[model samples]
Target: MTGDLVTGLRSALSIRFVNTGTGPCTDMVFTVGLPPGIVLLGGTDRVVLPVLAAGRTHVHELTLQARTPGPFDLVCTNFSYRDENHEPVRVTGWRAGLSVRAAPVVAPVPQPTGRLGVICETPNLVLGAWDELRILVINDAGIPLEDVMMAVTGPFSGAVPRSRISVLGPGMMARFTFQVNVAEAGRHVPLTARTTYTSGGAVTRTQVDHLTVAAQPPVPPSPPPSSVPQSILYLAANPRDLPPLRSDEEMRRVKERLQLARNRDRYRIEPALAVRFDDISQSLVDHQPAVVHFSGHGDRDGNLGIEDNDGRCTKVTPEGLAALFSLHSRTLRCVILNACYSERLAWQLAPHVGHVVGMRSAIGDPAAIEFSVGFYLGLFDGHPVPDAFARGRAHLLSRPGLAPEHQTPVLFPPGPSW
Candidate 1:
């Protein structure tokens, strides 16, 4: 491997295969296995060579990009070939270690007004990924500002329209977070933050920041098939105070679809009924599932409804759920939020989870059930998450009276490559 090893930067990995035997090797295959926190920028991880004569050497190079800042190992998980005797032989135990450093932070320039300072913290975004853009408003003047309001403009925007602060005291700072969707790659996107405040008089100020979007990272190679079944944690909640939902029917449909799948043996569904606010963490810790499915209610404010201690409806904020999911990110592959107005939570969870499926608007019971059934069928048929999402939408479109809600379900970082 060569090049600077840094998070958000590109690097190169080189693999050399040598044949020292008396005869030539045929049908050689080499597969590179990437650890968590590392992403392949381009090219396929698996390489094949038709033939390699004795005393011959072949080299393969791959482009890599690191996501998290830490140490990771690159292993040759599989290497095999047929020898002169026409017998298949396998080789393994090849590994390389790399250390990736965090990207350097650039300091924001002070505003010319000198009364108020605005700083926008932009992140390196991958194409089609959802990320957060933070803006810091500092009161540097001797006087305080009242009725402070901030509105963001540009490619990145918040789920809600604007952010406001009642009052900003002198020498104090307030931070604002906005969820941004990266649509284009290999270009710089500009973001403007407009601030309005009331001091001795009303005043308005604007600050701009530019973020560069890198090309989409290659989907990591699939791991070798394992004997252990992939666990799906299905959580259902229908509090007494909220309208009734067909939670049981959804579970039954999901199980029936999976049972008829060709790869039914590769998946196991674990249900947690009457889920309460506290049951989420315990279920996750106990099951350690690869995929999580939540069927319940959601409010317009993007809060998910769960059961309270008294069996009443309780709301869970997107921030809280995002933080909780981040803790188990290494093992969690995808999350399905099958509730009304759950797109905001999908944006919040995108950075922590691989793929997220959420409802953009209110959907009926029949549409939701059909989407889930089709989604699980696609997954069992060996399709990627994005494709499965399309299959789910197709299910809605194909059914009578359900086509109107076909656009309700959305996949974050919408891309076929994912």
Candidate 2:
């Protein structure tokens, strides 16, 4: 006997009767005894065969439904038949256990209401950045919708979160955000968002959107020989709305540390103060610097604070920064986000830049300056990016009252020998 006896729902059990005698058998009867909590759905408890030919087999199947979750045994209580010699024979000893698991709770399907709508919102999609994809589910009917499900399918890098709404009232809508990362860049990347709900009956709505990925910025001509000595572009921003940062002091200390290095002639620092949002891209193009450093304010969400047109604080997201830096990957070797809560930004920039340094948590001005000095000192001594990051942390620990922030600085991609 064989069956899918171990299940949470309905199952099937089959019994096989084989005649191994040289001649045919007659008057064969078989009975199955079922344990408690198991019900025979549509089959009888016993089966009888009028005649069984020699070396032939017959199968009887029983449909069973488990009423409770437990282990139960199905046994064959009786098996009697007349052998070819007109002799009666009885056999017993057929038992099988069924382990029934508890059935999962399923929500009831909602009744159809009126109409359902799906809307997809896609901002500027950039290659190799975690971009946001927003989906809105709207109930246009006059009734409520229960168990609304939203799913998205696209050429994304990782898993996309599934959105669910238990109830959506009439004229109500729910918005969901999906962090999508795509590797390929093209003029049009197709994205589809599907939403299922009851609108009168089961209704499904699909919204398709084409996303255009921006290409990398073009590289500008090389700077003249006079600017060849300047390889590091230091950008500092202090907007009026946000708390003022000691970026000037940080820049000054960095210049002094680099000047004192044994190979000072091989490197030079170019400072851009009160950096505006637009100036970031222009500076990279004009200087074509090997190293780009930003000292400013960063929010917990990893948005860097930069100057707007009116000299007010403006925010730049990590995704935007990653896309912008990708354009300079040909010439840029490393990036240092010397601001608080920049660890996430560092990770985003790692794919494009060879090395990146960021702060794991909020850092005070003194620690930031000390780290910048130590990091530059290491670089001047021909230490690689990771080693220089360690040097920065060591400097922070050695400073008076700054030891607590020693682990604030973090390096991405641990090893970048260059």
Candidate 3:
């Protein structure tokens, strides 16, 4: 039975009883035990079936009324009747239990007089780790707010809290929380949040908050190197209908490039969630990678393409990308985005990560591959992120017959190296 039971309402339950005897039976009696909060309203627990023949069945229904919200049970404690030979027989039937919840409380939307207010309660500054950003949006205008969308840009990565809300009643408020991760330790990293919504058949957008990032105490020194090889996570997605990217060749080249680094004792590369977008976080948590690399297509508007369940291209917004990276900000030292127009993502990720590299504009396939190959090669050679990025660019520049369009990859916020 449906368990959303409201007080003072009647609920009905039906039970089936069957007899498999050689002849008809008589004096049928069935007793039910009901738990507290449920009372029999119209049906009796004991029922008389004057005659129940062989291979026959009977259905018994009970009507009950709930007194309050709680769990209730209907147990058949005893079933006694006479068999074909006039012998006494008894059987115990199954019990059914259900929980009831209080009716939901809904508040009406108030009318506003033209004031819309927003407040953000976030840490004054964050360093070298992830934190939460809580914001409250109030519908102070006289009209109701609909289709609200929020965007946050800062040194963080992941989904923005309450990115899209269906409605906000006038004078009512809604609270949203976002995860903020800081990759690099610094002072005064600027953050901006904005909200756009439809009100009274018109669209309006406003900047919600201006925040800052601060440096935290440096992380403790690493323990003596262990025998385990350092893992590098490489995530790639190329959905259907888009120009085919050479991801397979790219992975092969990545292994080849890392091998050339010849530091097998220290680093081992691993491919994660080849084309699955939902498994990205699970892969990160399972691997705890030191470096994270994403190879996919990116749009100028800050949406990165990842495959949906149907293998179709699905765009993940900049805020979502940033929020995802924040989860691994502690272990992730560097990130590489080998996709076209990923600079926006890089900036959003730079604060919570040690280093981030993204493309300034569209980059050709050949150039993108070379850049990734060179970057990993430099890393294996003990070069820092800046040096690795430079090496990648240099390798692209040196490629034979390299096109002029290949030099779009750029590193973000080039000062105070991590």
Against the hidden reference, what TM-scores do the models get?
A: 0.51, 0.51, 0.50
- Point to the candidate with the largest lDDT: 1
What lDDT score is found at residue 91 in candidate 3?
Answer: 79
lDDT per residue as tens, model 1, 193-225: 677776644455443433332334435888998
- Separately for all candidates shown, the number of backbone clashes (residues 3 or more apart, or on different chains) is 0, 4, 11
Q: Candidate 3 — what's its lDDT?
A: 0.75
lDDT of 1 at 358: 91
384-413, model 2: which lDDT tens digit per residue? Answer: 878888888888888779999988887766
Task: Looking at model 2, report the run of 10 residues with the lowest lDDT sum.
Answer: 209-218
Cα-lDDT of candidate 2: 0.79
Error of 3 at 225 (Å): 2.9
Off by over 4 Å in 3: 1-209, 212-215, 415-418
